[model samples]
Target: MKFIGYQSLITIVCYLFFIFMSFWCIQDLHLERHLKMHEMQGKLLIVILSIVSGYLLSSFVLSLMDSLRDLIYIFKS
Candidate 1:
């Protein structure tokens, strides 16, 4: 029970961390030339892309960790 709660907390933290990192990384890109519309739209696009890519990255990492942990069961009785 407590372990599950800790896992959930870790998952949330990992997701937020990755999303923040992605947003920071994406901010460095000069994408103004690509957007013909308002500047706000470009920023919005960056936010959307950051969330998407971050979620994907975090999910991949967490799943990989879980898979590796599961391998221990195979070696056990």
Candidate 2:
């Protein structure tokens, strides 16, 4: 597959992973009451934004790695 396709797959996987982890943590810590309180106060957007930001951050890191690899290769020649 092309780079774009691979990047998109990675982004989606990362997004899902973040969402899954957040839910797992909330449940594991028995924070249901806190979650309900936040939800009632309309703070769910914070969670959603965090997931999206995590995905974006991963993408940026991946891009940086690619750039660094290219630079290393250039220096190796």
Each candidate's clash count: 0, 0
Q: Which stretches of candidate 1 lie over 4 Å from their true place?
A: none
Residues 29-55, candidate 1: write the lDDT tens digits: 846557675788888888998999999
Residue 2's lDDT in candidate 2: 100
Q: How accurate is candidate 2 locally (lDDT)?
A: 0.63
My TM-score estimates for the predictions, one after another, are 0.91, 0.46
Model 2 per-residue lDDT tens digits across residues 1-77: 59889878876786677666655554344343545655434345555555666666666766776798689878788
lDDT of 1 at 32: 51
| Poorest lDDT segment (10 consecutive residues) of candidate 2 | 23-32
